[model samples]
Target chain A: MTAETLLTWARGSAFDWAIGIFVFGMVLRLIEVLSLGKKPDLAEGRGSGVKGGLKTIVTRSIPRASVFAREPVRITNGYVFHVGFLLVLLFYGPHIEFIENLTGLSWPALPGGIIAGLGMITMASLVLALIFRLRNPVLRHISTVNDYLAWAVTLLPVLTGYLAYSHAVLPYTAMLALHILSIELLLVVAPFTKLTHMFSFALSRWYQGYQAGYRGIES
Target chain B: MSGPSVEKGINFIREQIDAPVASFFSSCVHCGMCAEACLFYTQTGDPRYTPIYKVEPMRRLWENEFTLWGRIKSTLGIAKKVTEEDFAQWEELVYDGCSLCGRCSLVCPVGNDISGMIRKIREGFSAAGYAPEGLIGATTRAITIGSPMGVRLPALKAQIGHVEKETGIEIPLDRAGAEYMVLLSSMEIMNFPEYLQAIARIMRQAGRTWTISSKAFEATNSGIQIGASDLARELVQRVVDAAEELGVQTVISPECGHAYTAIRWEGPNLIGRPFKFKVRHILEVLDEFREQGLIKTRGKEQARLTFHDPCQLVRKGGVVEQPRHLLDLVAENFVEMTDHGAMNWCCGGGGGVSANERADELRLKAFRQKKSQLDEIGVETLVTACANCRITLEEGLEEYEMDIPVVGLTETLAEHLVEEDQEGQG
Candidate 1:
């Protein structure tokens, strides 16, 4: 097929396929995980476990004072990427337009300048994270091949998106097509990989909190 | 392949792949913060002892058995199966290196209960017959004899005789209508009989009817330390039956750490039903006495002291504030460790680490975390609630040749108990 034809299919059919796979795979993964239900804690609870569970989903994101003291770098850089990614993904105008087309939803976008600045910062934070992982002995020891893969795949779309929007890397159509293709790669790989953590992290925290909260330990 | 075949290990771990385990395996962000929280890792600077890494076998098993990519890797001959060698290496990591102290759990940004997962991983490890010899022998003795340390009825009776003679109070035995059934660790019977005498005196002064049962006097569950739930249930069942048979209103777990957890937290689940009575750590009961004005101390210790929170008693057992409350009662110059209460460092010999004598050197090494905490506070007397913790602390202090004396909270409180009725007639 011609590049024009491929780009059209990539934006149209490929986008539909990516969304379908992303949603269906994520829902199925959740079913597989959630269906393996635990036995009800037959042990008596000392406090409200549900309250602790809900509390952890929020509290876990904010590091404990002691933990932050020890891990200020990871926590600080971690939030940089996370918060930056959220800003770029949800508040960028074109991204919002695409979401509107896909899900029949629209919301006001932040100014282009701010989104671009945050996108660059997020991309740089990911690089620093990668370097931190490689340089730190403990992190290097614990990290798997998938850890590097997760980082690489996550960084690609942000870089390509910024390049495409800036019209600096290649022709607008081609760069945008590559950006979409990288995103499709992310969507396809996500459910099968650790990116499933995006959804699973909250549920896992809830379970963990529920488990410890039974003994009245703060999660 | 040289050791016992791990097919049963595989089966046990396979069954443990629940939602939390699945999510923990999937959602670990590979940040390595858990290493900072782990005593073994921080003290030894060994990355292998990373809390999450200790359970790598289970994680790998989860992947190969449960995940699509893992299945593909297995088909492609890329994934490593959990071998005997894996068990052999991890035996050190799981048993010696970890205290199941829950610090890693508390520190995980993702909220993974790494220690709880380690406890689950041990079910597989022990079932595969790869557990340490010390724990195995203890578990065996726990099943055959009444105590893990092989303390039998005669030994307990002898200790009871000593306490009764020393205190001039008739220690009750198997009274049918006592309000509480007191359980003792073999350590308390063999090494720290002061804990027993303290209870005897305090119960007498509080005017509460309590007794020790010949059948279920042992509280520390070697089965729990050995990671055999079946055997742990049997051991816990003994205490339950003894308490219920005595028709007691409560079962007071003596100054032992895991003993409290094994009974208070894990008791109902082990027996698959609620007990006929409540369970409380002896400190909790004493703190109750303090709160109720039943405990009146005559004097306070002049020596500088700090309380070391036993991992199981405070972190796992929720007996956090009781020891502090009791310390305020008798300690004149009491101070706090840098990390006291729920976040306190382990005495390096919990989760059966002390029982597994093979872990002696590593246990002493992990003691540095506690030692550093003590050094910063520079207290002369270290008080703790758990008998296991007290012994471990004493050993650690002695290893560093530090002059600190490790005392049980019960014994410490008993020393200052207003010298209640010297003639023993309540």
Candidate 2:
């Protein structure tokens, strides 16, 4: 199929299928996870486990003191990439339009040049993070195939989004379609893959904090 | 049975991945901070010793069993299947390499509870019988001989008799309605009888009624160390039944780290019920006495002293501040290690590493991390609450040819106990 026809198909039925699968899978997987239910803590809690859990869900996002001292490069890049990804994903002009269309929610967008710059930086940090993972023997040893795959799938949308907007690579139409398609790929695989950390991170942090918190310790 | 099969091991792993496990697997950001937090990885630089990697087989099993895509990949033979060889190879990493110190759990950016997960995964390893032979022997003895060290009631009675005779203090046994039912680790009984002596002196001063249940004087749970909940529960039940029968208001876990964790924290969950009595570590009870001015030491140690926090006691048991508080009462020159308390380094022998004979070399190697920490502090004496850690610390110190003398915190306190007037003491 010509790029135009393929782009049309990917944006139409493929997007629909991807979104459907993504939503269903996410909800189902979340239900499966959240529903496993904890055994009652019969031991008298020294602290508020719920509060400790809530505290950790927030505190854990910031690296622990020892870790922060040991791993500056990795943690700094992580913060940058996450901030950039959230900004460009939620605040780009056409992205806002898409969100408005999807849910009638509209927001102001950053300027085109700024968004483009942020995307480039975000994508660069991701690439750098990938290289860091590959270069460190400890990281390389512990990493799974899914770790790299998740990183790549995550990077594509920003890269493609930047290209589509800047018209620096393929035709705008093709690049835009590819960006959307990449996002769909991420969405579809996310619930089933390590990307599930996005949702599970808070819950796990809470559970860990609660466990630690019951003993009056912040994890 | 030759002991340990892949199928049974995998089944245990399958049963262990509850919602928290699911959430932990899902939320892992692959940040590798857990590696830095793990002493095994930091000491050996082996990625397999990374805390999360220690639980990899179970994570893979969770994926294959629970996730749709993982199932598809498994059927297509693209995913690696866990095998007997995997468990055999991993036996060292799980038991000898990792101490289940909970440092990884504390530093996990996503709050994964890496050590707690390792503890759960141990259920599978134990089920498969892939655990170290030394731990198996200890667990067997713990159930069959009433103590992992094979000390029976006779040995305990003998030790108590010595303590009573030494101080002319009455050491009560099976005293119904006593305020405290004290428990002892096999290590304390065999290696550190001074602990018994300290407790006798401290309890008399505190004016608290305490007794040792000859029926359940053993405190350390071999099943906890080996990751057998059923066995741990059986072990915990002995103490529970003894304490309940005697109707003690509190049960005291002696100065052994995992004993404190097993009896105080994990006991309720393992036995599927909260104790009718509260569980307090020796340090906690002593600290309380200090606060009440019941424990008055005549003098403090003149030399530099530092505490070695047992991983289970500080990190898992949350008995962090009480140790420092108790130490403050007796150590005029007490110094904190660089990473003391909740984030303290393991003694390289906790979580049953000391029990497993095969782990001795690895345990010594891992002790270098603590050695380095202690060297930096340059303390004259090392004081710790756990008897198991004390023995391990002494062994490690001797192996390194370091001049540091390891002392039990309780005994240290006992040495400084004030000789009160010969009034009606108790």
Candidate 3:
């Protein structure tokens, strides 16, 4: 298909529904974040001076950085899954082209094959993680329904995208439509599920870092 | 691949654990975020010391021997067998690497109680006669003798006589029908005899009618530390029976962490009835005395002090503010450490960590976390409310080459007791 045909498809009913779902999901996520009781003041007694508070945030955060540094292999797998997922979501050829046409802003895109390949890898990693969670009783016991939901939503988009690319028994447009729907579902669920941990993890790490640094101790 | 062996292993595992404890053991996610919370992991940079890794063996057993997926793995020969080597490796990892401080439990996103799991594993080890020799010796002494210190009746009476002679105060022994019964840990009678003297002075200042039983006066319970519920109960029952015989309104626990938990949480459950008399930690008793203006403290000016919250006392007992309030009353220059109150770092000697010789390296490793916190405050002395914490901090300071002195809150208070205030008004 020509670039114009792809652009026209993106601006059609499928994209509009996806956008609506994305907006609604974001609102739901905001509600979830607000509901997690007040952010605890972890720096209550360490020190109170301006410099001390800043130091605490910085020092406490070092533990989190050290965590990633200490276990590079596991962390690298996590990084690839996250970064690759983001690249496909934001910089895929059709998505970027559509965004450029609509917003009058343009960015370079990864080739179709590269985006699809990255998508496949991200999906595979996520599947491996889910399998690990299930196979390990310790993890299985702690996991919530939402954790499984997150894996399913995360995997659905990639699976549908691959199916659309392969043009299986379903029409290519239908497969693309399902893929877009699944992606929208994930975007909406992100803020509500433990997936919102993405935001809280950074905040918690920063708070711990600041407290440790303020106290002039290695976190 | 065989199913019969897997079934046998599953039955063996089930026979070893109670239901509630087993369920809790099966709930870790292995995210290793708990590693960041572990001081041993931080100090030694050892992955095995990470709280998550430390519990992996227990996790594996819970999976392969108890769960369906684990059973499948066992049948396929994919699950590793638990060898004596595995036990030996885990002995060091669980005993020394973890203080059972509950810090990891506090930070767990899923609220997995890693400390509780460690305690349960310790229980398993203890049952299997695999507990550290020192800890087993201590527990054995505590069970056979009246106290873990093994101070017999003659020595205890001599210590009491010495206290009476020094203070010119009557140290009542086995005085039944008293209003309060004071239980002292063996550490106080053996190591810091002044603590017993201070207790007498406080009771006299308040004009309280109290007695100390020669038989059941020891309050230090090793069972709580070793995760031996039966022994912990027996220890607490001794105190309860003595309190009943004395008809006391309250039983005051000495400056010990596990001892307080033994009497407070496990005391009632073990005795199969709720205690009528209130159980109070020494810090709480002092806080009350200070509030009522019963005990006046002086000459704490040179002491720049900070309070280390004992894990059992603060986190488990909810006795945070009382100790700090007492410290504020006594010390002129009271500074709070970064992790004070319920969030305080463990002194690396709790949960029987002090008695476990194999835990030495892990203990020192964990001490670095607390050492760094103390260094940040730069205090002259670290005043804690628990006797175990006092010992742990003293050892930790020496191991870490820190200059800070570790003293109990009551010990510091005893040093500041006003001379005129000691004269009997009652």
Best by TM-score: 1
Kindly report which residue stretches of model 1 are placed more than 4 angstroms away from their true locations once superposed.
A1-4, B1-4, B75-78, B420-422
TM-score of 2: 0.96
What tens digits encode model 2's per-residue C-alpha lDDT throughout B1-426?
Answer: 223477888888888888898889888877788889887778787788888888888888877877777788999989877888778888888899877888988888778988888889899999988999999999999999999989998888888888777888888999999999999988889889999988888888778899999899999999998999999999999999999999999999999888888888888988888889999888889888988899878878899998888887888887788878888877899889887888898988888898888989888988898989988989899988888888888999999999998889889898888757622453
What is candidate 3's lDDT per residue for B157-195, written digit by digit as tens? Answer: 999889888888988888887877888877778887878
- In the range A84-124, model 2's lDDT, one tens digit per residue, is 99999888898899889989999899998899999999999
Error (Å) of candidate 2 at residue A196 is 1.2
Model 3 chain B scores worst on lDDT over the 10 consecutive residues at B20-29
Write down the worst ten-residue block by lDDT for model 3 chain A: A36-45
Candidate 2 C-alpha error for residue B73, in Å: 3.2
TM-score against native, each model: 0.97, 0.96, 0.68
Off by over 4 Å in 2: A1-10, B1-4, B75-79, B422-426
Question: How close is chain B to the truth by TM-score, in each candidate?
Answer: 0.97, 0.97, 0.89
Candidate 3: clashing residue pairs, number = 17
Tens-place lDDT per residue, model 1, B224-300, is 78788889999999998888888999899888888888998888988999777889878889989889999878879
Report the C-alpha displacement of residue A8, candidate 3, in angstroms.
25
